[model samples]
Target: MSGLAILLLAAGASSRMAGRDKLSEEVDGQPLLSLMCRRAALTGLPVYVTVPSDAHPRTGLTGTATTVPVPDAAEGMAASIRRGIAALPANTEGVMIVPADMPDLETQDLMHVAAHFHGGDGPILRATSENGQAGHPVLFPKRSFDDLCELSGDQGARALLKRDKVQYIALPARHAITDLDTPEAWAAWRAANG
Candidate 1:
């Protein structure tokens, strides 16, 4: 994890949650963004969280994680991904994209994905559910950095992921895909997890 950075994508509008902010939703007694940054930190990787702006409220909750301000946050996930990639350290050998809304992804889950990344020759590592459902916290090697930096719109890295050779790491249960975008989704998750 030393040469790798974790990008906690948190600049989305959460339009599906009505007027509520999904990243602000509580998980284990703290905001989801803060919890995710803390968990990513546990993996010993440099955590960079993308917020809507430098003054965005989520910026204050990122703790020790470096906050990457997304001035074009309205452009969607691609904007945050581009800025976050550009913000990574000059020597970073790999990067892990951890969507902040995935409240169930634990420190161990992240480590599992990072553990698969073996530097210069490492294939793109994508975390999947135990049952083989492809999902988040995807790790990309430095060779793919240019493509990531060229990303546009809300599509994220889907096109790149589809075209690249990826190795999947499975985490227990639904930890790899539990993204809570709506209030009902949050309620369902909290009720089940708590």
Candidate 2:
């Protein structure tokens, strides 16, 4: 119990990928979901991944990270968020919600967010690009867990982020905001980075 937990959101249908499973897509020779899970685990924080019932067998995630099946995942992103939040340990003073589709989000980036988390009294910590664009792996204090658990529909945590008392950490890496949702975006990312 490091006082913080990471909820890896992987339950989405990836509807825009044209039938391709983005989580199964490999980056640097490892599946995207597995890579994110492994990186979050390396930070020594409890990592819980929310995936659809059918996604567990293919995720290839083992060891430190726990896989939580979001049976109602098809309902929307809210379902996954609620499930993941409920699965967090009781001692979790804060949680970093990381989306599995962010290919450029590296292990160090996860560590950066974890390292910056203070405690329940601190403001929400969000990673931002050099240009001031807010990004994923947003750390929400325990104070906000109630609001998070109430999230509904496909909006995720955007509503929470808009509230006051949020702080941002600028990550030098440009990949903090890069999310591969479609085939073209995925191919473009590979061509640019690989």
Which candidate leads in lDDT?
Answer: 1
Q: lDDT (CA) for every model shown?
A: 0.91, 0.84
- Model 1 Cα lDDT, one tens digit per residue, 23-60: 88877889888899999988888899999998889998
Q: Number of the top candidate by TM-score?
A: 1
Candidate 2 structure quality by residue, lDDT tens digits, 2-56: 6988889988898999998888899879888888888888888888988887446
Cα RMSD to the true fold for all candidates: 0.9, 1.6
RMSD over all Cα atoms, model 2: 1.6
Off by over 4 Å in 1: none
* Full-model lDDT, candidate 1: 0.91
